[model samples]
Target: MSPTDTDALADDLLAYIDASPTPYHAVRETARRLEQAGYRALDERESWTLKPGERVYVTRGDTSIAAFHLGTAPVDRAGFRLVGSHTDSPNLRLKPNAQVAKNGYQQLGVEIYGGVLLHTWTDRDLSLAGRVVLLEGGKPRGHLVDFRKPLLRVPNLAIHLNRGVNTEGLKLNPQEQMVPVLGLESAGAVDLRAMLVKELSKGGVKAEAADILGYDLCLYDLQPSTRSGAHEEFLHAPRLDNLASCHSSLTALLTGPASREATSGVILFDHEEVGSRSAQGAASPFLRTLLERLTLVLSDGKPDAFHRAMAQSFLVSADMAHAVHPNYASLHEPKHQPQMGAGPVIKSNVNQSYATDGESWAYFAALCREAGVTPQHFVTRTDLGCGSTIGPITAGQLGIRTVDVGNPMLSMHSIREMACASDVAAMVAVLRRLFA
Candidate 1:
């Protein structure tokens, strides 16, 4: 790709990440892109009449999305070429009774959502964005909300209070230390619900505090994604771990040549950070059910058609990989150090943590070669445990050949993660080739 093309792709990715402050927003953003590409949205509650050469997508709980392009051939014979990623990231989620007061200051109670880098979240300009469940027209409804500006902040303890801070490292108590200050008590005891109602009204979403039954709000850094470094080669942003993969997969699906044989699809599941167990998660039957329905529809209800398709299907679970950290070089496997800007990483694990085996690895390696990209490899050190992706979970659930891969980056779960701007286009090229 040319430098201009690379910069454009990176810019679009940063915009996507910035727009998606929560899982609901991420899926909505994905849906918008897909719709612009002529992919029609399908209602799960309504009957689907799918046909070959048709492009359609469906969302579950406004958080997870599945988009696919039907092949010109029989789905059972063509099988599915699918890429998967997650919508959620490690962060702080608000509790049920999120309001709390301490030492003349008001704060929101939060619980750690995943393997978050607790210390990184301190002293950042934080805002709230998520789906709010409300009672409208005598029925429960959900609306997306974003307090776009900095509405909350978690202040760090001064160094003077802890002299051994650098040596002992920062220790945080989620229940106590992580509460983000909204304002001082002198500002008056502001009702959290009332604040939401006011914010909703500002967004033109009419709702009263009494109408808001509940919410799934979470705190996010208010920083915009940026391309840093001397050559502007580095992408500094939040939620790159999986959002980068999500954007790449979606771009490939939309831009790739229309498949004449295999069915191409991308499913961005929610709740991967906490474990893929939700209804729209990879561990659930969302993908399988969709595939089975497509087979039945395309094959005219042929017996065992879903099974036949599964036998030939392949899944590329695209989550961000760990680029060898500059400060912690010894933590990585010596022979398999994935570097930022090197290329996409083919992540592997013997214990099935990543679902990449010999067959799948060879398949993906060949795909990368076809796209003129040099694929890198990653494996956690033997003595240390490996973190997983949706690869193993989806593979086990659907019984499809799966390879786990991603663009490598530093700061896997930090509030802000860094990745190569070029790798975004590289991964897109390979994925588009796979779709082809």
Candidate 2:
């Protein structure tokens, strides 16, 4: 691809992330694109009987989904070419009994659910979104709720009141500072479910509490991702840490009408922001169940064939890589600071935080080279603690050879994140080759 094409692709992907304000929207967009490409939907409750050349998709919850295509040729047990990414991002969340009033101010109590930069949430406009369950007549009605506009905010306390805020640094009390102002009035009794029901009803959806089986909901900034810098070198947005990977994986999945030479699969999961233990998370049965079921479908229930396919399978855990911050260059190891647009990164950790080992990294290095994308290496400072990811967990669970990789970015968990514009296209190119 030429530089112009790369810029076009980055612009396209940034638009997708900007449009996907919530996990539900992300999954919905993904499913819509896959279906447009002729992928059939499957019911999770029923057993799967897949035929060669058939393409299918499935979702565990609104937050996670997987799509794969069966090769027209015999299914290779050596395992499928699996690419994985997370759909969730760090943000404030509403509590079950969320409504509360203080000093005539109507606020919705929120719980800090994951590792987040709390200071970033202050004074920024926020919107409500997520899945809501309600009753339509007698049965449960599952619906998605998105305000898509500014609905609430966590106003910052006046700096004059805390003279030492900058000097001593700021500390936020999640229970206090994180509460989003809902309205001026109390809105009568706190019926959080009812309020949500009414919101969905506006979308032509009517339902009750029992009508709601359950929902995975979250609030997001309605801010759009923008191109910045004099040379248009920087891309700024929310959830870029993994969303970049998510968009790249989705694009790669579509670039193919892939062949039976290998089964290419993509897993966009939720709850990674909170350690991935949920049903739709990496640590759960979603990936394992789907892989096992796929193997059986390919082998026609032959255990030996499934085992062989497993041996041939490979997985790429696509998450965001940290680029060295120019302002904080001292924090990164001199030789290991991966630069923005330097290329795709192959992340490694001896502590097992990332799943990549000698063989897996080598395999990925070959793929990167074939795609003409430079591959870099990442390892945390030994003294500093390392963060964990699904790469390690999924590798252990499936015993599939795996390499962890990502696009290098900065201010990873910040409310608004930044990455190089060219890096997005670079990673997309590498993924296209991997899926190819």
Candidate 3:
């Protein structure tokens, strides 16, 4: 990536991360862009009849999505060139009955979701966004909603109150300190359900408080994603841990030069931060079922077509990798410390935590060489426990060849994270080479 590609892609990524505050919103934003790129949306309830050289996409649970382009040859022969990622990130999710009053202040009770860097969230501008279920004709319908304003706060205690705060960090408890203040009790009761009804009305929907079934709301930082640093070389944004990978892979699938040799696409799953055990997660049969159905349709029900396709298929698991923090250098393996602006990193774990074996990584290494991008590598210290991605999960499920890769980033689970601007576009370049 050149200096030009660096700045422009950062601007584009800032817009993407801003629009996607929740997993549901992330899928919706990606789908909207895919539609503009000429991919036809498919509903799982409907029968699909796709042709060679056609583009199609489908959504499950409104939080996960899979989009692909059929090639000149059937998948049994050419297989599928796939990129997988997750949409969910660590944050504070609202509880079922969230409202509570304490010391004349109204606050929303929240459950700490995933592995959150709890302290980073304090004293930040926070807002809410998620999916709300409404009843219509006695049936449930989900709607995506975002309260774009900074309407919540988790204010930190004063230095005088906690005199040793600088030396001894403030202890946080999810059930107590993590709650965000909504307003003073004198402002009257802040009915969240009633507020949702008014918010839906602004969107021209005839929704009522009585029809509101339930919600999956979470708090997000209201700060916009942007490029930072003295030379504008760094990307400062929220959800960069994985959303950065999501944006790059999706762009490659959309902008990659037309490929007629094989099926090429990207699959994004939700709930990865929470073990990916749900219906819309990587552990579910959603992806396997899609591939099986496509094989049956394209191969005219030929015997063993599905097995043949699996044998030839490969998946690239894209997630953000740990960049060696300058302040905490000893925590990383000295030789394998990845740095920002060093292009994509091929992540591997000897225990199979990352699913990146010799053969799988070699394949992606060749792609990087062909794309003129030099790929970096990430392997945690031997004694340390490494985090896993969706790579091993999907690979084990389908017995497919898979490699784990990502852009180097700092602050893995904080409210705000940082990455290199050049690596963002460099990832897309290598992915394009694979599908080309």
Candidate 4:
């Protein structure tokens, strides 16, 4: 690809992150793109009759999606080439009955979600976004709500109050120091329900305050995803930990036209940051159910087709790789420090933290070469415990040969993260080839 094409891809990525402030929004955007690409959307509540050479997709819990392009051959013969990524990231989530009046201010009570970098959230402009389940015609409906303006802020304690902050580092109490101020304390304190009703009203969605059954909203940094550095070579955005992988997967899934020799799909899951234990998480039966249904359809209900398909399937677990941070080089495994802009990263761990074995890594590396790109590698320092991805969970659950890979990135769980523009192209290239 040309440099111009690379820049366009990076621009699309920044826009994708800006448009998706929450998991619900990310899945919505992905589904929209899939539909525009001629993929039929499937309702999980209904029976599926998918056929070979058909493109289709399905969503569960409105936060997870699986999209597929069935091959020209039967499932037992063709197998599947899959890429997986999660939709959720670390952040602060609003609690039920969230509004609180405290210390001469009206604030929202929030719970820390996932492995949040508490201090990075301090003083950043924050907004609200997530799903609000409301009663519509006596039936529950989930609405995507995003007040994409700076409506909340967690202000840091003044230097005068804590003089040793710089030397001792900023320590935050999630319960005490992380509450975001909504407004001044007055007779009419900020009502969380009223705010949601009004925000919904702007989009012509009418609902009474009492009609709202429940909500799963989170605070996101309001800064737009952008690039920096001398040559505009770096990406700085929120949710890049997994969203970048989501973008790559979606891009690759759309690159095909439903005529490949093998089955190919992308799985965007939710709740990975919080141990992936949720209904829509990788640990759940979401992907397995979809694959089984697909196999059942393509194999004409053969007795052992599902098992045969599983044996021939391959999964590339795409997540962000930890780039070698210049300031903290010692934290990385010296021999396996991946770099931004170098290429796609093949992440592996012997302890099964990342699900990449020698064979799987070699396969992914070969795919990178086939895509006209080199591959980088990542393994945590031997002394430090490794963090896991959906790779192991899905691999173990399905018994599919899985390789974990990603674009190299920095600030893994911070409010905002950074990576290289070129790596976005590199990772997508490899995934596109894998699907091809």
Report every candidate's CA lDDT.
0.91, 0.82, 0.90, 0.90
Model 4, range 1-436, lDDT digits (tens) per residue?
A: 2322788889888888888999999999998888998888998889987767888999999999999998988888888999999999999999997988887889999999899989999999999999889999999999989998989999999999999999999999899989999888865667789899999988889999999999999999999988899999999999998999999889877865447989899999999999999899999999999998888889756799999999999999999999999999998898999988999888888999999999998998888889899898899999999999999999999999999988998888999999999888787888888888
- C-alpha TM-score for every candidate: 0.98, 0.94, 0.98, 0.98
- In candidate 1, stretches whose alpha carbon ends up further than 4 angstroms from where it belongs are 1-4
Residue-by-residue lDDT tens digits, candidate 1, 1-436:
2322778999999999999999999998999998998999998788899888999999998899999999987878878999999999999999999888888998889999999999999999999999899998888999889999998999999999988889999998888788899999998778989988988888788877889898999899999999999999999999998899999999888888855578899999999999888999988989888888888888746798899889978999999999998899999999999999989999999999999999999999999999999999999999999999999999989999999999999988999999999999999999988899
Local distance difference test, candidate 2: 0.82
**Structural RMSD, model 3:** 1.5
Looking at model 4, residue 291 earns an lDDT score of: 90
lDDT tens digits, residues 281-392, model 3? 9999989999998887776467999989889888999999999999999999988999899899999998999999999999999999998889999999998999999999
Candidate 2 per-residue lDDT, tens place, 335-354, comes to 78999979899999998999
Error of 1 at 96 (Å): 1.3
Clash number for every model? 0, 16, 0, 0
- Model 1 local distance difference test score: 0.91
Q: Lowest-scoring 10 consecutive residues by lDDT in candidate 3?
A: 1-10
Off by over 4 Å in 4: 1-4
CA shift of 114, model 3, Å: 0.7
